[model samples]
Target: MKDIARVSLPGLHKSSGGFKSARQVLIIDGRGHLLGRLAAIVAKQVLLGRKVVVVRCEGINISGNFYRNKLKYLAFLRKRMNTNPSRGPYHFRAPSRIFWRTVRGMLPHKTKRGQAALERLKVFDGIPPPYDKRKRMVVPAALKIVRLKPTRKFAFLGRLAHEVGWKYQAVTATLEEKRKEKAKIHYNKKKIIVKLRKQAEKNVESKISKYTDVLKQYGILV
Candidate 1:
């Protein structure tokens, strides 16, 4: 395995001693990046024994005609064992899975070291929480707009996956609803806290006023 310290790339902080610490994790933002290019970079990092986490995989782009990409995926879906289709090859419909598979292809996945390297890689469709709060790095070399020609057309990995029956929209909608619900709950809790704080302040003011009156009547306060 190559030392991660020697492999310098954009957005990756350099360290002298390589990835000696297990806590050294690289969070990559896959938004607006070419799928193959991004996967290749990530595969290299993983092979170097560095843990890599790729988020926003849905935004990854593939260089080609959108329709032709869908057709290729459709054809891939048709591949199966004649004897037992269930026991043979499987196709992934999710963009994250597609990216993961792409990275796997770049590695020596059949070997134990490759398998271990793959175990260190994590790919996500969207920026889920914890990761959402974390800072994500971008590979300048892997950016679609940076590498692709101005006249060339491309398809988003998510869109291509959806065209092939990924149900991305439905899943995203559900996740959106859950996020909205959580936001609403948090807002309501904050409102309740403010209301309770105001009520407590009002009660304290009333008690203070009563004590002042009693003190004035006793000629203790003027």
Candidate 2:
């Protein structure tokens, strides 16, 4: 008992085995990467306890006819618990969410430990800040554009997301530009209102002074 009590924490490093190793953080770029292969690799790494951050999620690829795949998504979207939208099979429209759902299907997410492992995964739509400067890893087995034959045709996640009502299209300034223009119009209206208010106040003050002078002569007001 005395010998065990005297043993320092460092002395028990090998015996304890709990804190022997730390999990590594990994960044994967999804640009032109196959969705199924990427999901498989990510599932394997998550099982190994590595924290994964997937970027360029909109650039991820699904090898199928674009229109057919989009129709499938529409079918998924049509499924909704009418009584309660909260308890839903919640099909996501965003590319990042779609990629994440693909990864979840690969994992044993029914268990508590599996849920924790899934929590370690982070998915981003584009080169978000902080990750933009970091080095990203590429899996050669999962490349889409390279794997495709000259005659083959497939859909990209970005296009699929747009078809499914994803408003963050970097190419077309449809939603964003409209919002900016509306804001400018609002600001201009506010400026006009302020200018008119000041002019009205000045006219009112001049009228009040003239009335005061007239009243003084009549001794109605002092």
User: Judged by TM-score, which candidate is best?
Assistant: 1
- Pull out the clashing pairs in model 2: none
Please tell me which predicted candidate would have the highest lDDT against the true structure. 1
Q: Give the Å shift of residue 3 in candidate 1.
A: 15
Residue 86, candidate 2: Cα error in Å is: 3.8
- For model 1, the stretches where C-alpha displacement exceeds 4 angstroms are 1-18, 173-222
Against the reference, the lDDT scores of all candidates come to 0.83, 0.76
